[model samples]
Target: MSASGLPMRLRVPSDARFRPILLTMARRVAESVGFSAADAAAVGQELAARTDAVTRKAPLAETTPIDVTFDVANTNGAVFRVRARCGGSDLEVTRPLPLA
Candidate 1:
């Protein structure tokens, strides 16, 4: 939820790829909020620990494509914005060569 009280959503085709991008952005945001890299990592580590428990379960078989969106707010507590969705089949994948 944002400062104004709106739900944030974010989607990814798979949790594996989504985590890195999210973590990077979060680290940056934490730094902006006066957190050092070590601090950010510590926070991130805790979050990852919790998330790991949830994601360890199987993926949603029905949805190979994932969509994620978020309601983001600035540090000033004003100007709430929604970030673009960042997931789904948009990720590039190389086709395997056929066996001879």
Candidate 2:
């Protein structure tokens, strides 16, 4: 896929209720970039886990917004990255994408 639609950013409430939506969005982005179904799901899970850790360390207000960014890069290999930020806390997760 082209990079035109890349570098996407999403802002969602910090409530745990939004976790599923976040995970599904992460999975869909991974799949759009050629990740297998299982791999995409794994990526989503990893993002959720990392975000959880960050939020736990620095608790955010229920109405606080978490900004999630998704991007793809090609260096030695294709790589997908997800970054989540809330208040003063931030976390990033990366997964290698399968070569086409």
Per residue, candidate 1 scores C-alpha lDDT tens digits across 1-100 of 4344364555544356566655565444444444567865554554444443434554444334344333334455333232332222222111111122
Which pairs clash inside model 1?
9-69, 10-68, 10-69, 11-67, 11-68
Model 2: per-residue Cα lDDT at residue 38: 96
lDDT of 2 by residue, 5-99 (tens): 36988999888898788899999999999899999999999988877777777778887888999988777777888889888788888888787
Instruction: Report the CA-based lDDT of candidate 1 relative to the real structure.
Output: 0.42
Candidate 1, residue 96: the lDDT equals 18
| TM-score, prediction 1 | 0.45
lDDT of each: 0.42, 0.85
